[model samples]
Target: MATSPLQTPISTRRAAILQRTGEALEARLEAERERIGLWLPVALGAGIAAWFALPAHAHWIGLLLALAAGLLFGLLVGWHSRLGRSLFVGSGAAAAGILLIWTRALWVAAPVLAAPVTTSFSAIVERVEPLPARGQVRILALPQRRSDLPPRVRLTLRAGQAAGLAEGETIGVRTRLMPPPTASLPGGYDFAQRAWFDGIGAVGTILGEVSRVPGKEAAAPPLRTRLSAHIQGEVEGSAGGIAAALVTGDRGAISEADEEAMRRSGLAHLLSISGLHVTAVVGFAMLLAMRLLALNRRLALAGLVLPLAAAAGALAGGGYTWLAGAEVPTLRSFIAALLVLVAFLMGREALTLRLVAAGALIVLIWRPEALVGPSFQLSFAAVTAIIALHEGPPMQRFLARRDEPWLFRLGRGIAGLLITGLVVEVALAPIALFHFHKAGLYGALANVVAIPLTTFVIMPAEALALLFDSVGLGAPFWWVAEQALRALIALAHGVANAPGAVATMPNFPPWGFAFAVFGGLWILLWRTRWRYAGAVPLAIGMAALLAAPRPDLLVTGDGRHIAAALPDGGYALLRDRAGDYVRDTVAEAAGVDAPLLALAELGHVECNRDFCRWAQGEGSARRIILASHGRDRIEGADMAAACAAADVVISDRWLPHECVGRWITIDRDSLAETGGLAIYLGEAPEAVAALRAGDAHPWRLPQQLSGNDEAVPKAALAR
Candidate 1:
């Protein structure tokens, strides 16, 4: 195919153009080559993502392909096939990621509670989580001598019932334990799957009483829990709960209002044990160790100060991680922090995309499930954005201006914080929306103050208080910590209460989120000018809401709650007395935040004790929805009439054969398979269910739900 220039004499202009284009591409690729290794984790994550997106039937095939890729990659390497090696290696890494999660899932498999049981059991209390705000206590326990029960179960009881119980106490519990809950709505979080992975087969509430076991002895309370209790005691009110969260990673005591305030203000990350808290602990420990060691002239002369300080930092970080319950996010930050300290000891560039990739790769191997979590995405995105920011010329200049006046440097530092916060907010917006359906628009503004206050005042003071508490001299430090926490909480409340502080949208399409994630990575991972092109996909993702409007009808997994949007920009509920929690969740999922008015209250829909009829659209284009309200099912005669008239009929109970809807009929049996239904009405309507096609995972639904779904329209299984 290649003719020499002399054999196929091209025009001079065309030749010049081709040569210039080739040169430009070569230059771009050369830049990419410098950071090509960073793509390794991206490839690995891609495989993991593919596994989750895949149906249960395809899982084994995914594992096999990964194995094949690995074998092929080894062959290519041994054959010295350099060109083929790159292709196989990338695919092999991805495939390996698939195998990683598959193996992990199997490795952690445990029995799930099949049905609800209300009985008394002698259980060793593994952990007692206090919820002062809600006046509840969550008990993680191990049932003894009960072969019928799972090894571990979680119980929620009134705080007063378990007031004296601690981590090691053996307690008698009379509780109702049921299988962990599935997604509350279509695409909602799967508590059952997470519970399965956590070895918790059941979650329930104490129905009768909690008392100490006579035979077993209770050990001394754990230092972590003790610290949490002490911190909360030292600080008054809800601020104490936040302070405890900062120091111990236990957020059980935070009030609903405070949590909401913090979330809306974008300061919720402070409540979770992650980067900022870990960095503070490590950096402070290192600085303190270095300063103390420098006083030893011999240690300073031998140049062991930095190494020893780094060791101290690593030890402290590990300790803190353990104290924080070693949750995924805390563990992830600990690993990354450990790596950074190692890089420091090596006298290498400490922060780089390469470092970020390595950290991500390690976490993926250890806990591949974290790849799909918001914590992993948000934490990594923030760190990547900050590191990439420093690569920009403006930051390079700012960082290099060490000799500038102190006041000017202070001003510059504040400006840098503002810019960094803004940049991070933009990067995290899509992720927040994807997970929580809301993004704190003013999170950047809140973080500017909250971050500094937490880092410099609250956390440090809390640390000192803990240190001095060993000798009863911690009161002053405790006071200092409390005041700082009060300020932080106040700041959160103030920022969150502001108008338009957070923006919520409906569920964004998975395809759009994928594109946005890819585009964001492209911009942050590469240094070439091609990075600008990432904006195109990012724009497409942000425009997803406009492409699809809000759902016309929504129903809960239990079919107890149903809501529809009214023409007046409000909500009409089939149930006049739906619980606020159920109503709000459905409303938020439908991309609206409005009060729900009963169908009886809304003139557009006709409602009575037995049934409700809603007319959508006008003239021949209209669709009639006849919903069973007070009764489980319509009478045979009424059912036939409804079948002939209504476009769709919804019932929480099984309907007769004669009740076939003109377009679609959703009854108890259908709801049993679908879990939940979100139907968007239009010329060609679509329905999204809580359970998608081939969702036969044990944690998703009961095996008994294998009733033929072929009769249900395909749209009901839409993602």
Candidate 2:
């Protein structure tokens, strides 16, 4: 360079290139070091936090100790590292803080022990069973099972005469209390699990005798309860009983026809203190608060008034119902309303993803057991969708345009309704299938009509009724409210009975539900394109759906009769009792309307004394024949002969047959010259295999055997 800068040429150029390369490599290394230093501590902290937040029954002392160790290790790593040592140390400390918080939470929960058995008490009849055929009665009373008492303990009375019971009637009963049961079969409702999280346990009706006690009428209802009751009474007194229920969660006064109408129209959620009801109350309250605040110059006054308004709304919505003897849904609503108020107080222009996540995290951490409940899942799912949709560019752009025509505004409103319907439907469909095995086809349409009417008319009317009652003008308002409610009920009923209002699907396996939920959450929460990876679970669910096996036979009513579909494309009925459930079960599983019609169309329906006879006539006899009762002795004998000739026979009760072949037992043992196979319907995998292997002709046996043959094959097998 000293000699001549330009003349140094090739050697200089090569040195320069090498230097640049080295600098680039060093920069990359430094960046990598910094990234690791930052993220590693965060990961560690999250792990520690999770460990501490483990269920109350989980070991926490060991976890806390391990978290301390992790912090020490992280600190050592930072000290040893040259680049970004401060960053590493800071991250480690932050992680340690997170872990400490979780650990402290765990300790706080340690005091909660298993609930002790307490003396059983009685409940007064508040409402009779809405569905008489279902034989369920609902009661409200003080439950002695303090540990197992639901936030709102409603007794489900079985095999009891609820008809004569009126409101304010008390009855005593004895029963052992326990947590509600989990869903054991696919597509089965997990009412027990829901009740458990809500703090309910096993509830039974009075066994031998029930003595009715006089109900104590309140001289003056407490301020809040009085207001609620007054609102309800006034609305029903004026508009109709149905209207009061739609607004006040006082469905006891609603007529049976109105209740049915609401269910059919999918407007039932509006009548309950669910998320929608809460949202309406909060939304209107917020609007009113904003207007009032706009009029007030003092910022302090605005803040106080706003929060007070929110609290008032929460009260009106039944958010604090549990504390005031209302309902669980009301409590949930209150929690959500509080979250919204907090967001507003924070001066946020829009609800952020972080805030939503934080709210959900707080709720989940506080009530982890709520994860098992359909209400929590469905409510949160709907909220999440609302948040996402509200933030989307399309919605934002639409809202930004203020100069749009009235027609366009109406169109936008309609669009909003459709979007809401689609989002909620998608979110709840999986849960509905998992729980109810049926989907409401017109849920969206029902919501469109029901939500608006309830929000603008019913709820407001009830609120006004309360004011009128306070001023001694209760009777007039009550009559008006009742009439309005009647109209709403009629609307719901009409929509519910409309053609194709509900779609019933085959019961899916529990794992299918699990995967579907996982997929949905992943899609909803994950921020990256990689989130699409959740589709894998969805695909697996679809595959499961396709792979589901159809049952060959279904028996209902104490298994005295059966409806069977033969391989020869024929349907046969062999039952000592009516086959309605069996027929419906088969039709539902097959996704066919009028299975009998299909059978007739295919010329498979035949009047026969024995299913085996029908099978033999068509030369397409099944390898196995399951008889619900032992009444078909001749059929049983023929089935045994078939078993001797490479077939299998399964019966609910023992069948007497001497000329049959060797019997195949589930233990893989062959009984000499009996032809009767004693294959345990409910056996372990190994036992099933043993039975199959020990049998001389395994393939000749029924393709499958199950206790509940009507259930989908995978679900039945899982049981």
Candidate 3:
């Protein structure tokens, strides 16, 4: 077909305009990449995500490809040549994927997973701490024979039976070690991956009696461990636990009830060694050093006073980190503080998102698996949002009026704290929902009281207590610290007990989380009006809370119990009092408020010890039956009734042959193979096995299906 000359020019002009627009967009993207200084962290995070997206044990291929792509990108970056939009996007994504694959491969390289075994071996106890449950303790041990395994393996034992065990003592253990549990459903928690990164090769309970053995030479108890024990020995009750937690990052001694209170009140962050603690420690040291220097006029005039004070503050932070055992969160705080110090020394603004990004990059490069943890996400999100909000024009305008009266300054300070707390809470709400499926509603009210008390009273007393301990005069200071902690605990409990103080929601899907995260990063990272566009994704992410589909039934991974969705937007339990954790997990996932009450109020479910029956739809719908241990001739009547009444049956014991023709029976063998099941009810009911719904991966072990695995209802037999 021939075209007119006028039409041809118009098409050509349109093509040119489109090309120019694309070039402008590319230019804008490039400018953003340079301005944000977040490329490395984003790339690293993307790599981790890519690794998770792949099939288990398939990271090797991805690693190789990532290596090649990384090298190519490095060369291009080194050449100082402008990249086209396609090349830039491709190279960036490829580079990120490479890091993810590398991290996964590195994780798999642990010797325990290389050649897993389940045999008894003598090990040396590195440390021992009591579990939340009474009469149980967790022991961190070093294996004598399996030197190829991880440096540490966590073992559980009955404290009453293993009372003689001590740190640095050799002990004989008889246990079958196994890998950690994987996610029961997609986007669920992956304890196996977490354990892998924690350097825990295997986890198991002690089988036989513990006996003292002489295998390895004794080593001294860790300095941090000794200090924690000393603190515990000195004080009593929750106060001692709080004191130890503040000083040594050991919260094992804290009671579960108190821990729950803190979590519900949003004072949980106070217990963790984070930026707040680091800042308080450093500020105290800096102020004391400066005052001492002022007292000595000659030293103050030496011109090294400022530098020395900065170094002293940094040294104080490092000392506190060492005291806290240098855990991941503390390490992150130390690195961030160090970056800020360096930036200040260089005569640059230390408070910026770039500092946070730098800290994140360092942590990711050191331990990429941290990207998956709630602590990392929450810490980084809170810090980033605070910095973005405070550094922006809004805060600057609010604080622009300077040299006000003392009372006015005090009021402004309180206002600033309120604003900061609100921003942090809002920013981290999505992450809390995605990871924990809940948000602390009255957290702001609690924080208003707890934060000031902790920062001003509790932390200072702790510092003085530690200082006095070095001089063997710590009792009075320690008492003061305990008093502060007591007050803080009381506040947390009171606030947590408030009605409607916690909001629970279903776990957001991975894509939903991604949308929220990107939306947040968009608002935080961008320097233009386009940042407001982030609200689109944020809204979509929030919509997921209402859009997520609720399962008709939730079965535990071990298949001990199941919860059926009720018409009143609650769950009905098949059992009254077994598998509380499992029941709570299911209820939390379904966003149920009171699991026990929901179960108690179920009118549709009718059951005894032998059999239970429930129907979802009115007519012509499949009926559900829970068949327990009833295999005798008398119980045959119950089985026959279930077969006649229900279309699908889940039995704890063996199923009789006569029932197989009439119903789809999920017996013991089926559950042992599948782990769990989620049944969805509709016009056509569908039962999805937890194992079948998930990918075949290392974290999730394989289950063998025997020839008898197939059990179809007689209604579908003709088909």
Better of 1 and 3 by lDDT: 1
Q: List, residue by residue over 1-719, the lDDT tens digit for candidate 3.
A: 89999999999999999778866765666666654456557656766765665644456465646656756765654434334433455456546555554556465544343333455566778777754224478888886644434556788888775664679787766665665565554345667767656656677777767766435444556767677777777777677777788888888778777887898788898889988888888878877887777787777778667677889999999999988878778999999988887887789999888998899888877777777789999899989998988878979888777888999988887888888888888888898888777788778778888888888887787777777888899889778878888888898898888888787776576777888888888888776677798999988888876687776776665455667777667777666765556665676666666654434346766666566666754556545555453344434554576576666676666566655523456767777566566666666776655454345443444221111112223232211
Q: What is the C-alpha RMSD of each candidate to the true structure, in Å?
A: 6.9, 12.8, 7.9
Going through the candidates in the order shown, the clash numbers are 0, 20, 1
Best first by lDDT, ranked: 1, 3, 2
Candidate 3's error at 189, in angstroms?
Answer: 2.7
lDDT of 1 at 486: 82
| Candidate 2 lDDT, 280-345, residue by residue in tens | 767776677657765766754555767766666655555435423455455555666666667776
Which candidate ranks first by TM-score, i.e. highest? 1
Q: Which of 1 and 2 is the better model by TM-score?
A: 1
Candidate 2, position 181, lDDT:
37
lDDT of 1 by residue, 1-719 (tens): 87778755566778889768756755665667777677789888988887777768577585667658666865754434333444566777887877788788778777677767676667788888888888898889987666667788999999778766878676666677788887767657778878867888788898766666555555767888888888888886788999899989988778888898999899999988998999999999999999999999999999999999999999999999999999888988898898899899888888787788888999999989899889999999999999999888878887677777899888988889898999999999999888877889898888889998999998889899889999999999999988888888889899887888878788878888988998899888888789999999888888884465677788888776788777776667888788767776776677665567777667778877777887876556478988877855457776698667888888887788888888888888898778888887778877899877777454654321111112212222110
